[model samples]
Target: MKKENLRQTSEKVWGACALAVKAHALAKKGARLESHRDLWVYKNEIAREIGDWVKIVFKLADSMHKNFYENLTTREDVLKE
Candidate 1:
């Protein structure tokens, strides 16, 4: 991918991950249930959301890394006139 495109993609991914984390934190803080079962359910929901976000982050990171390495090896091709 082009440098600008890559930059934009990474920025979006990072922003999404950051937002997910923020949401998880807010959910934890807002969990005011007194019952153990309710708390457990709330925690599970938050954890699942966080986990999905984490997966997205990891996948994006991996894609970025792979793209970087592949592009590096093909630098000469990119520079060809």
Candidate 2:
């Protein structure tokens, strides 16, 4: 049961991290939104992304194992940057 919960949590967090990256890309131009609609949408997406990230953090902390964070990123991925 513990293992299952950890797996689910890991997947959720990984998905949320992808979302954060998407939001970051969208925000690269700064928040100087031109139209009212544009600003509203941008704020909406940012809020949702932030909320999901916080939820994932708390969930991970709840049942996190000692080595749960170990080796999360691959050496090749890091080297690609």
Tell me the alpha-carbon RMSD of every candidate. 11.0, 12.6
Tell me the tens digit of each residue's lDDT in model 1 across 2-64. Answer: 664554454454445445545565676753454434433454465575566554444454444
Model 2, C-alpha of 16: deviation from truth (Å)? 1.7
What RMSD does model 2 have? Answer: 12.6
Q: Report how far residue 75 has shifted in candidate 2, in Å.
A: 23
| Model 2 lDDT per residue over 39-76, tens place | 43554465575676544443333223222455353333
Question: Using TM-score as the measure, which candidate wins?
Answer: 1
Off by over 4 Å in 2: 1-4, 29-81
- The per-prediction tally of clashing pairs is 0, 0
lDDT scores in order: 0.47, 0.45
